[model samples]
Target: MRIYVLSRQKLLLGLLFLFTVGGILAITQFTLTTPSLVRTPGTYYMANTPEKVVALTFDDGPDPIDTPDILDILKEKEVRATFFVLGKAAQSNPDLLKRLVKEGHEIGNHGFNHDYQQRHLVKEMNQTDQAVYAATGYHTYFYRPPGGFVSKTQLETTNRNGHVVALWSVDSKDWRNPGVKQIVDNVVKNVFPGSIILMHDGGYQRSQTVKSLGPIIDALRARGYRLATLSELKTLDSETK
Candidate 1:
């Protein structure tokens, strides 16, 4: 099981190889390097820290069904997470956005659409920011580019807009509808201190994702890991620096 999960991890890392030479790209600092708590300005992957903590983050969400179910699970477990929401979804579900903030979970911008190769980067960021602000009156502090694809231009725009580019170290791959147990192992086995675990709440059926939440939270807690929102993790990164 460990080998299988490790292979999946390797594959995801390759898919997310990230970064560029000159024009701007993602740095591969998310690859579990200890004592390398280096902070790349305007961007974040896994924080370089040794605290027994990890952030639970969801992307492409604010789905009325799956998101609420995920929220219910989170609420029942008394765990707070960070949610990356689409602009259109947030516009459609203002109440959900308010609920997330009211419930103490942090919200992030996922873009106006899920165009992983979107061309209108600035527009997408603006629209999502507007939708979030309209719904909750909170400007998003974090932004995850579509499909974790960041360009130099996007980074500059995000910085100008005062948003941090967020990435993940551990991917649940729940979008593949991989079994609940596999999803659990994908996250549980890959996490290190200050790891950011990515899962999805919207964009699909996501029942497996909803189901895996309890076990993922339970396993991490049992292993003496404290789950946190990405904001908290970033704050820790700053204080330690």
Candidate 2:
């Protein structure tokens, strides 16, 4: 009995030791030992400003049907946004690209082919710039990677090309087709001062985005938020700093 009691106490102590060690390792590995990644220079996730303004950015577009409807809504609301154009899409729909430029909206390079690896980021960026320039005689100064994914090479190339990397703070997730009301709520609820809203005008069937656009604008306006382009947001960011 004495031996059995000693054995049981030893087992309990052993288990306690194992649990404590495991907990320490888990915390250290995931928390203190892990480093927070530094955002590369010349890249912006969202503009920093206290003003009641936001930038609406659309990605993967120049879609013929939906892009026009989005533009029409923007025009009706007298609000401007930034369209991050895919090189292939821009090449295929130069007229839409032209319309984007002519309508006082801003354009940004979204990369060619929507390549995920972005191994040749600089080339992709230049090709996108060329496609837009060919259509509208305009040069884009902002770069947002396909799928909003960022890589060190992409950021370096954007910096090398003297363009700013624009990423979004508030994602509409309209690409998910999560219903128009859900999309609007996703954006409206997440938005902050100088927020850059991520939406879609192309890359896939974006009908839901089309429907959510006007309501998002009206809701934002009702919330006393002034919509602006990426460039305008950048200007506001500068003033606050």
Candidate 3:
């Protein structure tokens, strides 16, 4: 009887452990997927405005092949975007970084080497900031955590460094290489007023991203949405308030 009782207690303990783990995972998923819930004082996923303005942001870039093409498309469309470029990439492709600044695109730090560890947050950000400034002579006020995996401590460190943590409301998922149509549909269907759309210009083969760019721009414009840089979108949001 004692052995039977002990076995039952062990089963209860095992179930309790499973429940705790599941609850933690559920919270993490919610925080990652729901921009509004996760946004803290220094983070912005979407602008709180009724204006027909949206921000388009690119991450992990300044790619030698794909970035130039993406820039050309943006120029042709008369659209300005914010690029959250990695430090190493910015250092290696300084000319591309300069071109980005010269063409009036905003630059943000994506960390030095894409390190997402809490302990390395400050160093990664500072290194990226230095690289961007050295290349473009422009200071960036925005920082995007690698993979959107930000801890509270990391967010606090970022804010302490005078950077706004930028997240996205509409994710194009172009990084997945899901296909050009799927990428376009994801942006067009999900974007709303003051939405910040996430796309990638580097970190992998981004030919599809470049191809989908024109269509995404045209569709959004047709929907009466104006694409703005991250800073401009913030201004619009503030003005409406």
TM-score of every model versus the real structure? 0.82, 0.82, 0.86
For 1-241, candidate 3 gives per-residue lDDT tens digits of 3554458889999999999999999998887765534555557888888889999999999899999999999999999999999999998999999999888899998988887564688888888889998987888899998887777788887899889889888889998899999999999998899999999999999999999999999999999999999989998776436
Task: Please identify model 2 stretches exceeding 4 Å from their true place.
Answer: 1-42, 239-241
lDDT tens digits, residue span 1-241, model 1: 3554458878777666542332232234442232123334556887777788899999888999999999999999999999999999899999999999999999999999888776888799889999999989899989988777776787888888888889888888897898999999999998899899889999889999999999999999999999999988877784447
| Candidate topping TM-score | 3
Better of 1 and 3 by TM-score: 3
- Where does model 1 exceed 4 Å of error? 1-42, 238-240
Cα TM-score of candidate 2: 0.82
CA lDDT of each prediction against the hidden true structure: 0.86, 0.86, 0.89
Q: List the residue pairs that clash in candidate 3.
A: none
RMSD of 3: 3.2
Best by lDDT: 3
Q: What is the lDDT of candidate 3?
A: 0.89
